[model samples]
Target chain A: MIQFSNYDIISNLLFATQWTILLSLAAFIGGTSVALLLTAMRLTRNPAMQTVVRIYVELFQGTPLLMQMFLCFFGLSMLGYEISAWSAAILSLTCFTSAFLVEIWRGCIDTLPKGQWEACRCLGLSFLQTLRHIILPQAIRVATAPTVGFSVQVIKGTALASVIGFVELTKVGTMLNNATFEPFKVFTLVALIYFALCYPLSLYSKHLEKKFNVSR
Target chain B: MSLVNLHQVHKYYGDLHVLKGIDLDIKAGEVVSIIGKSGSGKSTLLRCINGLEEYQQGGITVDGNEVTTEDIQVRRLALSVGMIFQNFNLFPHMTVGENIMLAPTIVLKKSKAEAEEIARAMLLKVGLEEKFDSYPEKLSGGQQQRVAIARALAMSPKVLLCDEITSALDPELVGEVLKVLEQLAKEGMTLVLVTHEMNFARDVGSKVVFMHQGKVWEEGDSKTLLSDPQTDELKQFIGAVL
Candidate 1:
């Protein structure tokens, strides 16, 4: 049996956190791009485009994130294509993050008064112009708090990438536990690292809510 | 020549008819005040004129151009017809000056300096020149409505449509907004307004239109219509609201 020192376990886990942060940023930036497209399609006057977006949102949201990761990693490989674990993890997490982000932003848009649309239209602003100039400005104010709050969820979600053999923080912690037979110390450190990453985001979201509310 | 003409215009929401074969005409510098009970289709008429709500049949001509669902035509009509709402509808996120300057800069493609100049002039016209940097939420209801009027006038529209601009204001605040409208009338701005202020309509309106049950029930010079009612519905409406 290879014995592991406390310093070795902590250091390995800290190194793995870099991967976790990288994956989280990848998923967030990618998810936001896709979410904006989904939101625009959902808001379009075309019923068919709206239905397609709705189904996409429902499929991602209704299924478990773990199942989605398995499908991307295992199912894609079974179909005779070589896929990297990194790609699988990112693809699944991005789809998962976008589904929730679209709904959150769409709710913000819906909160605006209907008269806003009418008023903008009367001013000769087209649909896209109206959205850019009027609707989105207001929606962004309402969406900021919830959007920042959801980023904490995305950071936490990066832990699930470990199950797909991504070698993130959780995967590194499990390996350390096996080598040292110290489940408590290893998992406790893992939890602490996640808390460090997420707590500031949670606090920031609350601050945004308070700031916007006061302005309103 | 009439600046706005609605000939046999009809509008429906599903099976419910909201405007029925209405014919109206207003020459330049005319102040036409439309008044009626709630659900009398007064607001719908104002919306149809601006193409915010499309009428099912007939034609609306503003400044000699027919109102259509075609994007360019509607946009052209919008250039000449400005509208204000009961709720004010000033963009809450933008400052008063930005709100006033938005359409002119974007739709009219005015330079920032030009739009700012127009915004300042319009705000001055509405007596809110001091509110350039203030957000809508920071203002009282009356002040916000005045800002909305300035925002509309920043486009230099030939005819302004106001749908109950003072209905949402508090009792004391209503007077301020109505006073601004009165000032606009004095300046010879062709105005179409849906209002609950019967006294203002009588005093300032060149023509008063009484809408009931999706039709123009009675219309005449404000003084003639207020003192002498041709229909029983007009008599009852005048009695209740007054």
Candidate 2:
């Protein structure tokens, strides 16, 4: 049996925690910008524009995140390009996160009453003006809770970055377990850390959901 | 020149013909009320004047702008033709002030301060100066409808279209909103209204249009149209209402 010092295990895992947080932040920001763009295209009147956005959303949502990371990391390498694991992780996570974000935001925008559009039209405000000044302002309130809840999913999803050899929390836990040969102990710690990161966001989203009652 | 004109107009909703071979003209500062039963195409006639609906044949011209086209020019025509809906249709997310000021600021390029002043005056005119900061949902149905009227007036439109504006309000609340419209007519704002209020139609309007089955059944001075109907259709309509 291999015996390991708790102090060594704790130090290594704590040191790697920052990478997971950084990955989550990167994915969220990149994904949100892309999602907003996709939402605009999705709502546009042009058929060709709507089709392109639809295909982009479906392609990302239909594929597993694990397959996406492998394809980004190894598949791209076969095309004579060397991409770092961090780059591969971010690219795949962003694509995956944005697809869901676009759908959520589109639902928010769609929920606004038809009268709002007519009212703006009677005012002679252009389509973009209506969206910016009227529609989006109301949509922000409906969008807040679901979007914050999705961030928790995104934080947990950072774990899948480990398969591509990106050294986030899951990778750190695996490495520590290999040295200590304590699979149960290491995974428990990983689960606790994930809960620590995700629980506050989960609670916040629930509170907002209750306060807004936007489902109506 | 007429302030509003609809010539030989024909409109269809897929297989259902709504407006058929209609012709009408209104001069500036005229108050005309159209009375009809539900689905008699009263609302559709009002919508077409503001370019909110398209006619398959003939054309509508409001303030000299053609409204039958699908281009921005049609929207431009709508700028001069402000419409208030049956439901009030106030932007619920906006403050009463913002609802009134949006078009003037965006389409008319009025400065924020100027628009606010104009919006305040318009709201005050409707007896809603106290509710400027309140949202549409925060106000009563009558108050919201008044705010919608103020919103339409803030554009200083050449003509105003009211489509069943008082139909959604409580019976007690209807007078307050009509009082505001009465005040607008007194102020000589050119107005075209579709209404169910027969007493107000007889009293407030100089000219009254009676519509039935998507055609103008009878139209003339309000007193003559109501008191001495020239057609059985108008007699039947007034009989049913009375």
Candidate 3:
């Protein structure tokens, strides 16, 4: 049996935690970009475009996250594609995050009164102009808190990438427990690290919700 | 030629017809008020003229352009017709100044300085010049509605449609908004209003149209029509309202 000193385990887990942070960032930034495109397509009022986006959202949201990671990690390999575990983890998490975000943003846009749209129309502002100037500016208020809150989910979801042999914090914790025979210590440390990362985000989101509510 | 014209116009929401066959004309520089009971289609008819609602039959033209639901055409038609909604509909996120400047800079394609210049002028006209930096939510309802008028006027439209612009204000606040509209009417800006204020309509309006069940129930000068109704609907309406 391998003897992992306490210092060895802590250093190894902390090093692996960087990957968790990096993976979460990759998923969030990519997920946000794609969500924006899908939201624009859905709001275009074109039936075909709206239908395509609706299907994409439902497909990702309805399935389990683990199943999606498995498909991206293994299914892509079987198809003769050379995707790395990092790429597969990012791909699955981005699709998962974007699906939820599109709905969150659309809800923000929907809460605006129909009169604002009519007023835009009457002002001779083109659809794009209205969206840029009036609609999005207002939607940003309601969208901020929810979007920040959803980031917490993305951080936790990166732990699932360990199943595909991605070397993130959770994966390292498992490895350390096997070597040190310290599952309680390793896993508890893992949980605390995640809480440390996500708790500030949760608090910021609550702060923003109250700030916007006051202005509203 | 009339500045605004609607001929045999009809609109339907599902199976329920809202605006039945109707014909109307308003000459240049006319202040016309549309009034009736709730669901009389006064607001719907005004909305159709501004291309906010599509009519299934007949046509509406403003400043020699036919209004249609074609995206580009409606946008083009909107250039000439500015509308004030009942709820003010000001962009709540922006300052009063930014709200007025948005359309002109974007839709009118004016330079920021020019749009700002005109926006300031419109605010001055609405008597809210000091509110240039204030956000919409910070203003009173009447102030917000006046800012909405300034927002619409920044486009320098050929016609202004007021869709019950004062309906949402407190009873005490109604006068301030009405005063701005009165000033606009005095300036020979063509105004179309859907209103519940019979006294203001009769006093300022060159023409008063009473709509009932989606048709022009009565049309005439305000004095004769309000004092002596040609139709029983107008008489009963005046009785119930006044």
Candidate 4:
């Protein structure tokens, strides 16, 4: 076993947090793009398009994220493409994030009264105009709290990428623990770092929930 | 020729026939009030006129243009017919000024300054000129209903359809909204209303229609219809509400 100084372990974990942040951001931005498309499809009058989005959502949501990561990591290898751990992690996490986000935003859209649609329709606004000017502005208020809350899940979910050899915060923690044989010290620090990132988001979400409670 | 006409219009909600063979005509400057008990299809008839509720059979024509299921045609018809709902479905996120400006700017393609000017004028018309920047949730039910009226009028519709606009307001606040409508009727805006205020119907309606079992059970001049009992249903309805 190699002996590492306390400063060395601390510096290494902090450095690894950069990868965790980058992965989380990529997953969030990409997931939201795909989720918007899914939401639009879900709202369509076409039964076939709606069914396609529904199956896609259920496929990602019904299966475990860990299993999805494995398929992207290993399944692509079987197809003769050289996939990097970073790309696989991003792909799998994006799918997982989108499934949850589509459902979250769809619930937000449904919360709007049916009369809103009728009112806009009677005003001679087109469907896209109604969504842009009327429906989405109202839905964003209902969606915001839960969306920020869900982002905390995305940040923590990046830790699972370590299992597939991605060098994120958790992977760095494991490596340090293996080298120094200090599981308790290393994992407690990892948990603290995660708490540092997530707790503020949870608080902010609650703050927003109170601020946008316009129904009352 | 009638400005608004419905010929044997029939509407259904799956197996339930809400509007069965409704025939009506309103000329320019006519104030027609539709009155009935709950489930008597009075509101449904008003909705059908605006194409808010689709009829399964027959036709609705406004200004000689037949209302159809086509989006473009409905939109064109919407430019001529404005509707006010019971719940005052103002865009909650918008200020009263913005609510009035939206349709004019987006649908009519009016310039921002033009829309704002129209909004200000309409707000003044509704006696809520000071509420230009206030959100709908900040206003009382009566104030919101008046804002809804201003929003509808901002479109410059030839005909205005109001569905139980005062039923959702407090008894004291109902008169404030009706006062605005009465003012509009005096100005010669063609108005169709489904209402529960028996007094307003008797006093202000140029034509009062009594709906029962999905048909026009009785209709005549408001003063004549309310004073003379032509049917048992009309007498019972008037008795219960009056």
Q: Across residues A1-216, which tens digit of lDDT does each residue of candidate 3 receive?
A: 667887888889899999999999999999999999999999898999999999999999999999999999999999999899999999999999999999999999999999888888888888888888888888988999999999999999999999999999999999888777879999999999999999999999999999998866
lDDT of 1 by residue, B1-242 (tens): 89999999999999998899999999999999999888989998888888777899998999988887666777888799999999989888889999999999999999999999999998988888999999898999999999999999988899999998888889999988888889999999999999988999999999999999999999999999999999999999999988
TM-score of each: 0.95, 0.92, 0.97, 0.95
Model 4 bad stretches (over 4 Å): A214-216
Q: Which stretches of candidate 3 lie over 4 Å from their true place?
A: none
User: Over the stretch B133-173, how does candidate 2's per-residue lDDT look in tens digits?
Assistant: 99888899999999999999998888888998998889999
Question: With candidate 3 superimposed using the best TM-score fit, by how many Å does residue A154's alpha carbon deviate from the native?
Answer: 0.5
Which one wins on TM-score?
Answer: 3
Over the true interface residues, superposed, what is the Cα RMSD of model 3?
A: 1.0
TM-score for chain A as predicted in candidate 4: 0.97
Q: Quantify all predictions' global Cα lDDT against the true fold.
A: 0.92, 0.88, 0.92, 0.92
lDDT of 1 at B67: 87
Candidate 4 vs. true structure, TM-score: 0.95
Better of 1 and 3 by DockQ: 3
Candidate 2 stretches greater than 4 Å from native: A1-4, A214-216, B68-71
lDDT of 4 by residue, B1-242 (tens): 69999999988899998888989889989999998888989887887777677789998899999987567877898899999999999998899999999999999999999999999999999999999999998999999999999999999999999989998889999989999999999999999999988788878889999999999999999999999969999999888988
Q: Give the least accurate 10-residue stretch of model 4 chain A, judged by summed lDDT.
A: A1-10
Q: Individual DockQ of the candidates?
A: 0.68, 0.54, 0.78, 0.72
lDDT of 4 at A161: 98
